[model samples]
Target: MFLIPAIVLSQRPFLIPHPLLATAAPANASILLSGVLLSLVVIYLASKCGAEFSKRLDFPPVLGELVAGVVVGVSALHLVIFPESGMEASDSVVMTVLQWLNGLTPDALTNVFQSQSEVVSVLAELGVIILLFEIGLESDLRQLKEVGSQAVIVACVGVAVPFTAGTAGLMMLFNVPTIPAIFAGAALTATSIGITSKVLSELGRLKSKEGQIIVGAAIIDDVLGIIVLAVVASLAKTGEIDVTNVIYLIISATAFLIGSILLGSIFNKTFVTAVDKLKTRGNIVIPAFIFAFFMAFLGNAIHLEAILGAFAAGLVLDETDARNELDALVKPIADLLVPIFFVTVGARADLSVLNPALPENRAGLLIAVFLIAIAIVGKVVTGWAVFGQPGINRLAIGVGMIPRGEVGLVFAGIGSASGVLDKPLEAAIIIMVILTTFLAPPFLRVAFGQPEEPPANGEPSLEPAAVVNEA
Candidate 1:
């Protein structure tokens, strides 16, 4: 009877337990819940404050959010670090606070920390998915169709130039091995559609001709990046490329995008009819999320990014009569979630690798500079790759492609995990990603010309109307 009571009380830690029960009480669940809630509070506060400050400084708000994440993250405060980044529970200030407040043992703290980081990571993933979906809805299908060829050319050039040049340069100049060189080259090929699109949307240029071409190219770039990653990752693990997997990714990616667009009309009509029948409160928005999440699920299930499916879903829904209402509904949701994506991307970037004072980092810093130069020049030239758009903002298009963002980090992470990249090479790739990701936003604004003066209220008025009305 006493044993049963002690077991019950241990699980419910809030209750005042007998002396034996108190020592056995495990608070991992409650600690996880508390840590997650606190993490969210930090995320939201940092996001809004960073965005507001950036906006005031005449920079893209996303850049501010990224910077804010860097401040609170591992490099500085240690408030929001991740386990995958090789950080421990003790390294996290938030975890420390929770442990102190809840009197958690070290073992319990580790479990709570891991669980909390995972929840935040999942939230960040969803944030990007929602952001892409919003971008899709704002995009005009006809415009995308018009610029499809140019976008393809840009994407192809962007991938080919960087891969060839970076791989050959690394092997010849740095005396690097073939596999690691190939991996670094592959890292250069990624263009963060999320970052570029968010910046484009903020600049109120999402519907412009240049914007269409950039968005379209970025979409194709993502698909191509996935294929490159698959090939290189296979090479890393087994020392041979898997042709069968490569072909499957190519075929499936192409089929998925084309098929999604082709069947969009049918999906739209069915969606509208369903919304008309539903009498519930979330009749419109809830069903929309269901389709979006399902499409996202399908994308991940097939080895592609979930954002692609969400984006494809948005394109389908853009044809619906409910587009306007749906856009309004989604904006608040995006505002809430999208910052998490941007902030986490910033947080994961460990800037200590760039410190040249350390003997080990000096070599990596030199390689990073070379990679950065190549990264910029390779992507910039893609602008001139456009054949038909005689008067397009070619420079803006090129600049838009510069940010490697989270996609580049994925390459670095895989390289590190596979044991193909040494410290200097891995640090070089990460530094390259960090520089490219930070530089693009400010440069992109300049490429488009000086930003317009703000209204009396001081906000840039980044509504959908602004997106549609931009020249």
Candidate 2:
């Protein structure tokens, strides 16, 4: 398949007289197009190397991609520095990597790359949207329904304990105001469902009873996390949290989710027949992918995370007859983009917030460390809250829920952008997320015991018949 720029430029034009020519090369040369492409190459290479290194050490590949981003991002190498700091970036020995590859001095280099990050960030968000959609495609609604009660119970405890603990820890001890405290607490919610599922898949236990429980609880946690983020973000954005507005936000989110799922599922199957009449053959997932983006846009308009909408779209289509074909098409797209999302997320972390020389920042660091502890114990306790399934190892379920990778970053990123979470708090949250994310795979590995080695062929093939063209 062709790369992304063509898709991004579609259906858009510049001046009325010069529409299609807008995409043609400008009269003067610019290095930015080449720089961004090279940046992606560096990012992909760094991510794969890091991911493989982590896998060799019995860790999840997500953790490695994240670390690689930080190592090569503004936080470490200053390979992709901002223009303001580029003048004084010489202290970083890793700056040489950027110099040797791109062949530009720091300040000039930064100016060239800065314009590209905004575009890269937009693409990264798209990557995450695709990931959530792919996850939804793979999930079974009936299984989620069966575990609803247990999931609700565990999700509530998981959200509540950490939120209260995180908020209070920041407020009472550090004298943090109401808004940042709330953002800090909200970050602790939402166990990384993608990370947990990956670990379970590695262990080949996703079909197990324990795995089912964890998946259900994580879904519920996503719902609860959305509500908390909505409420807290409202308080931060408006500087006033009315009881009625909070109620309205909750009701609106709930209604959107329920209505989307019901109407989406109905429309998915019924409309496909009508759409097919105008159809070109072998284009099943084109409509599915477009609908996923529409839902994501709708969710944003309603003040919830886009992933929630994308996820709902997944659930809507999972029960349809076209599920298999849609999944086959979307998986490759997800695979191509998901690494960019994860790597950019890590690389964007600004480690300067934790500098000890800044007296005020020290308190935030302490609060971060404290929040990490609370985040772990909070999720761990949920395992004990499970009612049925006596044979299930509750600890494994708890450990599975520990990683807070992408979802936690989404919450923190919004808070930082909205001016609710300051640099220290945002950086601290990033550290806490990294630590929490790193712990989960090792914990799951130990809890589930060692995995057996693959046969002489190394591993089985992933390509299915549907993924290949039948000439």
Candidate 3:
């Protein structure tokens, strides 16, 4: 009969409807999208609550963000499961409970978290790119020139001492490889100008010579840090550590930066003119972002990091008539993306590594504690190096530079991505970042001798201080 023939045809492999087709094609896509949205909401809420609590307790908001990450991340409550090959073979008690509760196999759970983390990672990458671009936008060549010699000395000393100390310490004490140790040193070199500026501004010392020196030194430190990152990342990629290779990397990175800036500066006006002819003048952000992405691509082509390209893009645009407009438009995007970066970095921290009962975990904890001490001492030493400002409180300046904040986290994230910083090491790095961020405010307050803020007669004083963004 016709019914029998139809049933036989339907039973064939090709006759079967696809699962998504049976529902809607977007069913899987919707689930992934929903998962990402829900995850962001959760992370944002936790970060806000944590930050508010920290502020109430007189700590930086980043401490709260890290706390939020640990609470939801892989090593703690595991609320945000990560898919790792390790998880497939893991006899982890927590993983078992999660698997059973979710009615999934270990493999399935790993796949799910892998998918989730991938989405988060991409957003986080964007966050760092936007951050560096903003920094480039804010760098006024005149201001840096004004600070001049003193700032240069501080930056050089600050970078050299920490780079040497961190790399040597990690290598000698932890037996870490040359590559990982170098990356750790690079991570230690950043001074969070944004965080330091806030404390100085609150104390009404932002216009002080010490403040100018600190800001100038910090700007220099950023440029140095990025270059160092370039060298280390290059070495890690090449798996070479000789002096010849080292020199080559440094020269290459410096040339790339110089070339990109010069080229961008030369053509920026023409590029803007062309873009202005487009419909995006009403929202120039579109062209602004395109330039950033294009530079990023060029950086990749030149064996430099995309971040440098993004930074170059910002440097070029900073000179344009639309500089302020670009900042205004890009800032909102950065605000949304930057927090996602920090929170995701925090989530990557392996809290299990801090467990005292496990031998390895206890060792990791010791490493974390040691790193905190070194991180503090490393930056504090630079405060004393402000020889030009003999009257400046060396202690205050050093304390001001101590907080690693977002910048340190960015370094750590890159190290991990490059396979130089393992889970235990990254956890240690995160611990250091959190503690330094928390400690700097209180230490800086004491160093500055907590002034009672003068009453504001109008709007707040218009003085140059660190740009304290939510990032």
How many clashes in each structure?
Answer: 0, 0, 0
lDDT of 3 by residue, 1-471 (tens): 000011122222212332221232353444445556667876777677766776677655655666677677766655544443134313333334445555655555444344545666667667767765765565554454466677778777778887788889989999988888888887788787655654565455655666667766775676576567657766777776456644654576567666866776667787678667877354578878888888877765554455666766877787788887777677778767766755665666555655678765665577788778788888788777766454778887777778776566666666676678887777677778767765776787778775434447865443322234443
- Taking all chains together, each candidate's TM-score versus the true structure is 0.91, 0.78, 0.71
Top-down lDDT ranking:
1, 2, 3
Write down the RMSD of all candidates, one decimal each. Answer: 8.8, 7.2, 11.4
Candidate 2 per-residue lDDT over residues 1-471, each given as its tens digit:
001111112111110122111332341014555555666777778778888887787676667777888787767875543322222435333334445655766665444444445445666778877877776776677776677688778788888888898898889978888889888888898787766765665565554566767877776676677667657766877877667755765687679877977786678767478556655854677778778899887876765657777878888888888787787788778767877876775776666665778887786687778888988998888888889767778888788778887567666767776788887787778778877876787788787775433345866422222132110
Residue pairs in candidate 1 whose N, alpha carbon or C atoms collide under 3 angstroms: none
Q: Which ten residues in a row have the lowest lDDT in candidate 1?
A: 1-10
Candidate 1 wrongly placed segments (more than 4 Å)? 1-26, 451-471
Q: Record all residue pairs in model 3 with backbone atoms less than 3 Å apart, i.e. clashing.
A: none
Residue-wise C-alpha lDDT for candidate 1, range 1-471, written one tens digit per residue: 000011111221112222221242355666677888899889888888898899889898889988988988877888888876789999999999998898878887776777778778778878988988998898898889999999999999999999999999999999999999999999999899888888888887877888888999989998888888878888998999999988988898899999999999988889999999999798999999999999988887887767888899998898899998998888888888888888888888888998899899999999999999999999999999998777889999999999999777777777887789999999999999999999998999999876443466977554453533210
Over 4 Å off in model 3, which ranges?
1-28, 81-108, 148-152, 166-244, 260-265, 271-282, 364-369, 387-397, 400-434, 437-471
| Overall local distance difference test of candidate 2 | 0.68
| CA error at residue 168 for candidate 1, angstroms | 0.7
Worst 10 residues of 3 by lDDT: 1-10
